[model samples]
Each structure stands twice: as C-alpha cells, then as structure tokens.
Target chain A: MPEKPSVRAVLLGALPFLAMCFSVPLWDRIDPIVLGMPFNFFWLVLWIPLSSLCLWMAYRVDRHRR
Target chain B: MRSSLLPIGIISAIVLLGSGIGLLAGSRRKMDLEQWTVGGRGFGLILVWLLMAGEVYTTFSFLGASGWAYSRGAPALYILAYITLGYVVSFFILPPIWEMGRKFSLQTQSDFFETRYQSKALAALVSLSSVAFLIPYLEIQIAGLGIIAQISSFDRIGRAPAMIIAVALVAAFVFAGGIRAVAWVSILKDALMIFAALAVGIGVPYIYFGGIGPMFSALAHTRPAHLVMPGATANMGHAWYISTVLLTSLGFYMWPHTFAAAFTARSAAVLRRNAIVMPLYTLSLVFIFFTGFTALLVVPGLANGDLALFTLVRKAFPNWFLGLIGGAGALTAMVPAAILLLTAATLFAKNVYRPLFAPAMSESQIARLARAMVIVLGLLTLYFAIYSSTTLVSLLLLGYAGVTQFFPGIVLGLYSNRVTKSAVFAGLLTGLLTLCFLMFSNHDPFLGINAGFFALCLNFTVTFVLIRGQKKNRLLSIPTTPRSTPK
Candidate 1:
C-alpha cells in the first residue's frame, strides 16, 4: 500500500522485537541492578519506552513515504 | 479478617458506580447489530486505545501475572515478552485486516474467514472453535472476580455468590450497552487498575524491605536462581521460554475479541497508531510483577499461586485501600468478560446460526438472538468458574493454544491468493485435532517444544502441500490480488 515499506523501516520496526526475543542471552543476567530494579527487569522496563520509540520512527517513515 | 464490612461496602459501591456508567452510556443511542457489535466503526484513537488495553489487561493479568512471578520467578517474564511482541506483530498485520473489514463491513472475526475463503463451512468451523476457545477465557475472568470478592470480603461472602453477583451485573450492563458500554467502562477500569498496581507494587517493597533494591538483594541472598531464568522451576529452560513466547505473541490477535476490536477503529491509521502506543500499557504489567515479587517475601507458602497477589494485599494494606484495589480488580474482570461474551455471541449469531439455521433471518432478529446468547453464555461461564479449579494463567494458555492455530489461515488469506479454500479449511482442522490430541494426552511439551508450536508447523505443512496439489488440478483458480471480491 505504501510502496512496500523500506528495508530500513522494516528493520527499524523489528528492532524491539528482535532485541527482546533473541537477545535473551544478553539480558538474562541478574547482576548490576539499575535504580532499585534487577538488571533483567530493568532491561524489560527500558525496552517498554524504547520499543514505543522504534514503532513511532517506523510509523513516521511509512507516513513520509505515503 | 478484621470486620471486612467497610471494604466490602466500598467495593459494592464501586461496582454499582461502574454499572451505572455503563447503563448511562447505552441510554443516549439506538444501536443496530453493527452499532452493537463494533460501535458503527466510529471509534477514534483514544477509545480504541482504551478498548485494546482493556481487552489485553484482563483480570488474568491483574492477578495471574503476579501469581506467576511469585511462584515461577523468571519464567513469568514470558508474559512481558509475548505482549510486547504482540504489538509488534499487530503493526504488520492489523492494518490490512482492518482494511478488509471496512471493505466488507465485517462485524466479527469469523465473518472475515467466511468472506475471504468463500466457504460457509470454513466460517462455521472458525466460529465454533472461537466460541469454544473463548469459554475458558471467560471462565478465568469469572474465576478472578470470585477470588477478588472472596479475598476482599475475607471469605464472608464465599466464591459462588460473588461470582453469581458478578455474572448478573456483567450480563445486565452488556445487554444494555454492548461495545460502547465496555469501552466507556474500560476508561474507568484502566485508571483504577493503574492506581492500585502502583500503590501495591511500589508501596509493598518500600514498606517491607526498605526499597526495591533491598528486596531483590534479599531474594538473591536467599534464592539466587529466582532472579534468573528457569526461575524456581527446573523445566522451563531457554527452549521452552522462546517457543512459548513465540506461540503466544503470534496467537495474541488471534483471539476473537482482539480481532474484532480492529473493526471498531475509525481508520487504518488509527489502528496502526494504536499498535505503536499499546506497548506502553505493558508498563502496568511490570508494576504487577513487582507486587508478585513482593508477595513472595511477605506471604510465603500459599497453597495456590493465583492467591498470591490478594494474600499480599490483605496482609500489607489497610481495609480502605484493600477495598479500593478489590474494586479495580473486579472492574478488570468484568470489562473483558463483557467483550468476550459480546464477541462470542456475535460470532455465534452472525456466523454460525444465521448462515446454518436461519439464513432468512432479519438484522433485528440476529441482534435479538445475539443478546439472548450473551446471557446463555454468561451463565455457562459462571457454572464453570464455580466448578473448575485450574490456575488462571494455565486456563488462558490452553485457550491461546487453540486460537493461535488460526494464524496460518488468516495470514495466508490476507497476503497469498494461492492458498486454496479447501487447504485453509483442512489446515485448521488438522491443527485443532493435533492440539486436542497433544493436550488431552498430556504431551504438551512433546519433543521439548510447545504442542501448539508443533501443531502450527503441521498445519502450515498441510496447507502448503494442499495448495500445491490444487494448483496442479487447476480447479477454480483464485484471484491473485491482495484483496479479492466476495463470492
């Protein structure tokens, strides 16, 4: 519909998903607490905001293409 | 149980207030079947957000999330993983599905199948399975309500009566207001739930162990592995975690209610924008997990994992605050129950009944039958909620396994015209039969992968092979356009 979304846009859209699903090995550690939260829990909490940003960026790119 | 009357009274008042708001929303507008089912396709960004969030964060998430965190530990993170990925998947899938819905004036998820594949039998199959899957989902909400009422009232009221009262209230509001009622009530439910979660999650750790850091430190000192994956259990390792997450995320929008919610959006852009923002709602879930972790330290040795969150709240908070949280939890249960019954009833009436038994039925006749079915389904769910004793999370997972089988059918229909109608139908049946066989025989993790994942694989293979065979026959070649006209 919007000229097959750019590969860059598609990759940007998938960043959060890949980061959360595949990077389990990287962020599954419990050491080095961040702001009173466990490192593992903190990683998830951080991505909540970061994923929103990724989606927003993808949305912007798609909107511009349209 | 210190004279729980004050809190019980507060909870009753809150329930009444929510029902009153629901009833008032229905009074101003006249609803046809379309209006009743999807709000005449008039919802904008905010209403869609509240409705989507409302459906996603059910009572199961309210209590079961913390319950999983308290009991299973690291495996509980799967809840967060699946939900975020669900939004990511929605960004790619929902806009096209929403476009199809608008083009066909589709009211239910089953309607899409019927119109897309040009087969009534396929539509009926989808409708039947969706309704069957939705029953357990509804039962969990009804069960959650019973638990909240029992705990908040200090077991003075008992679970059955609490559930019956909830059933009556939900049935009444849904019969009067439909989707609009559910959406408006969600706004209030979302607000109250956020407040309650924040109060319990942050308040419990700070009050008991000085802060979140100390609480985790103490947990690590006592149960070091609890802070990591495989958690308190031995079986849920990396493989189990990845497969389960993938299965549930793919299955997220496959829920009939979630699929139907897309049709309510004002535009495709609204649906897309909502997908981007809906991940923020998972933040509330993080707070719920905090309370669950806190509960592990405060209320140890609970017989049932489902009771963990309530046990912690009753032990830690005052009567007034407990009542407030109970109110939030009750709304959480009721809101989603309303939407489930609405969607299931619509599927039965429009997709199953009208096409099979009463093809000549008028629009008003169908609407009347759907409303009646709502009451019937509500009563059936109430009976199961009172009688069944499974954990909420487990019940939800079983439902997910069944519904996720729809994934291949839906995706292929949207993107590929080469997939024959017969192949889609056969694929769904094969997937469902495999799922039932694996689950009933208690071989859920057959070959160390989730049964649902395996079932999906079998389903796709069958579909692919059948489609290739059909191409050789050259039998009624389907149009290769992205969207085809209805037969």
Candidate 2:
C-alpha cells in the first residue's frame, strides 16, 4: 500500500466530492448562461461525467504509478 | 380504519416470512461472534454492496423524502444531495479504514480506537458515546418502520402494534443470522426498494400529471418559490444550505453501521468501485423527489405531509400496486433496521460489555452477547417508535446530527497520524455537547439544521489546536504501514 494517498489520487477523489459540494453555489453562478437546466439539474448531470472521469483517472494513475 | 386490517396483516405476514427465511438461512453462519457481528470479516463485495445500500437507503429515502417534498416544497432536494454525496465521500475515506481494519483485525469502532490510540478508556468512551447517539438513530429507523407499516397497511395496524411487530421481526433475524442474514436480506430489500421507488416515482407522475413536464409545471404554479432554489427563502439561504450539505457529507460515514461495513469490504478496490457506481443508483431518488413534488400537485392540504408519498400512491394507484409498493416499503425499513440493531448490539458487546464487564470473555461468548443485545436493542427501539411524536423528517435530521458527532474521530484520525486521543476525545465531546444543547434547545433558523455540523466544526478546531500544541505527538507513526503483515 502507498504510505500516503497519492496526490494524484487525492486530486482525482476530490474532483467529484468538491464538484458535488460546490454544485449549489457553482450552479447559481452559471445558471444564467448554462442553458435551460436548473442549477440543481445541472449539478446532478454534471456529476455523471465528472464522476466517470474521476474514476477513470483514478484507475489510470494507480496503474501508471504501479 | 375498519377497511385497513387485511393489508396490515399481509404486510406483517410478509415481513415475518422474509425475516424467518433470513434467520434460518443465516443461522449456520452464527457459529462465532465475529462471524455473527461482522460476517467473519470476509463478506463478499456483492453482500457488502447490499449491506451498504441497505444502510444508506432507508425509510428516510422512501417516506421522508416524499414528506419533505410534499410539505417543504423543493428544498427536499437536499435529501438527494446528502445521500449521493455521502457515498462519494466514502470512496476516499473507506480504503484507509478497510486497510486499517485488516491490519489491526478491528471489530468495532472502539477496537480501532484502542489500537490506534493505545487507550482502552478512550475506546470505552467512544463506545458509550456511539451507543448514546446510535440508540436514538436505531429508534428512528424503528419508528420509520412503524410509520411505513401504518401507511402500507393503510393504518389497519396502529402505531404501537406495528412497532412491536417490526421490532420483533428485526430482532429474530438479527439474533439468528447476524450480519450474514442482514446482508442477504438487504439484496432483496434494495432490489424491491429500487423497484418500488421507481414504480412510485415514475408511475405516479405519469398517472397524475401525464409526464415530467406537466408535473413540474403543476409544481411551479402551486408551490412557493423557496421550495426550488437556495435564494428563494430566508429558510434556505445559500450559506445555511451549503453548510447543511457540508455537515451531512462529512458526517455520512460516521454512522456506526457504515464503519462496520467498511471493515467488511473484501478489498479497498471494491469500496472505491462501489462508491463510484453508487451515485448512479441515486437516479431512483430523482423519482423519489418527483413523487414528493407530484404529491404536492395532486394532494393539497395534507395534515401530516410525511404520509404524502403513501397518500398520493393510494390516491393514484390501485390496491395491488399499493400492495406491491407497501411490500417494497417494508423491505426498505427492515433491511436497515436489521443492520442498525445488529451493529448497535455489536458495539455494546465488543466495546462496552466485554471490555468493561468481561475482558476475559471468549470470542464465542462475545458473539452470544452481541446477538442477545441485538434483540434487546431492537425491542428498545420498538418502545421508542411507539412513543416517538417527532415527524419523519425531524426524526431523520435529528438522527443525522446525532450520528455526525463521530465524524471528527473517524475521518481525521485516519489520514492524520497526529490526531492524539486526548485531542480527539475533547473535540468529539465538545461537538457532541454542542449538538445536544442545540438539538434540545431547538435553536433558530428553521430548527436551524442539526448540531452535527456545528459540532463537527468545533471538534475539528479543537483537534487542530490540540494537535499543533503537542509537538512530541507529531511523529506521525503509520498505524498500518503498507508493507506490514495483515494482523
């Protein structure tokens, strides 16, 4: 096991968590320009890709580092 | 009321039949306490997922979500926010916990404390605090079961009897099968729940509003503006909403059963994979919130809005569909109730009973004590359920705030080796006391979100200050060195 959670892994892990966290605030700002979706809806949908990408990146980094 | 007897009886019978089967099936695995309490620490990934899913998705998701939507309008979306965010937060948190559990052979939260801090008193302190926090939490689940039973059976069974029956079935399965039974039952429970939630979430809107657009349009017309967005109401100010979300997200993993399940994961990879996929499962909750909102449009002037989901379903659907949903609701309540009562029992047995009263106790004896305590705790929850006057949403929020008190110890203790036991203890105590005072006082800002968040804030601050002052304690020993042999 790595002695510390990889910095890359931490960053990857933080992406979905932080995105979900700031979703309410972030959506409020972009709601005006972000098409027809409500900030909440945008928050939920944006998570789909971010979560997917984070998981993918997490895997790639773990494999590359190994 | 006179027309409701058969449905209530049928739900009771279904619950009993499921519990009985789970009991008998899991009995063989109950040879030792560790097996009974923690499933021999080798529960497969599928079982772990079911167990995790069961714990996360409870009556709160089913009934409480709808109730909030029906009564409070759009702010109920926070339920969806917290539940989904909780799992994602766990992805980063659980691997370290699982690795530590494997290395230390930890069984309970207290066990982890004991090993990490080398302090039995601290372990005992956590056990006591956890039990105090979790009993009410378990009681809420029991109370939830009672509410669902009443709703499903159309109130044929009164709250008191329903509580008794609910608690009895849970106790029987937990006493017989232990964690193995809870997990197996959770699979069926979760499947039925997802199916039922979707059936109601999708079916109701379609039947009542004809589709999603019409449903939203109806809500837009009727409900107040604050229900939709943060800035809409003074009650949902941006700072408070964001803070509430932060508090809940941080505290999500602090629930006792969550910790217990983390220790049972087959590998760290399984946990990360599970967290990634789990949020998608939250699509069911989108339906849940829709069900709540649709209830607002269809059923106006509800006296007890908590029953809005059931009220709307009964209004929109026929008897058989109601029966199907009723069964699903029972599954939702039972799966988590079983895990919770069992986890509480294990906490009491391993942390409190064995350590304080029976340090010489064998693993088998400890297992027996745990099983017995499950029954005792289950019955106690029944008593609370029967007596509880709190609304479903209030019960859930109160439980969240109570459970979140453990956040400081569990999360920060993992990554930061400098988190001294004294600092953690002081921090947790300060947070928990503040939370209790706030909970009892019913402080401002719309019951002003539970003390869990505020408590967490103080707890972290104290831990930080304490950690900084203790320079000698900052050696940062790796509790579970990566290359070290698993205990």
DockQ list for all candidates: 0.49, 0.34
DockQ of 2: 0.34
Considering just chain B, what TM-score does every model have? 0.96, 0.92
Off by over 4 Å in 1: A1-6, B391-395, B472-487
Error of 1 at B282 (Å): 0.5
Query: iRMSD (Å) of candidate 2?
Result: 3.8
- lDDT scores of the candidates, listed in order: 0.86, 0.73
- Candidate 1: CAPRI quality band: medium
Model 1, B1-487: lDDT tens per residue?
Answer: 3989988998998888888888877778897898899989999999999999889999879988998999999889989888988898888788888878888889898988887788889988999989888988999898889889999989887989989998898888889889999999898899999899888888999989998889988887888798788899877777777788889899999999999999999998898799889999899898899888888888888877888888888988899888999999999999999999999888888888999899999999999999999999999998898888655446566679889999999988877767778898898899999988888787878777788988988999999999888755654443233343322
Model 1 achieves a DockQ score of 0.49
Mind giving the per-residue lDDT tens digits that candidate 2 earns over B1-487?
3356556555656676678767775766535776776777786668778888888888878887788777775466666666677776787788778878888888777787788777788788778877776777677777776677777677666778877877788888878888788888776677778888888888888888787666665555554373455423456655566677778877788777888788877788878777777777777877787788788778878887778898888788766667667777877888888888888888898889888888999877787788778878877777667767655435456667766767777776776766788888888778777876776677623345435677777888998898888988365464666443322
* Model 1 TM: 0.96
User: Which docking class does model 2 fall in?
Assistant: acceptable
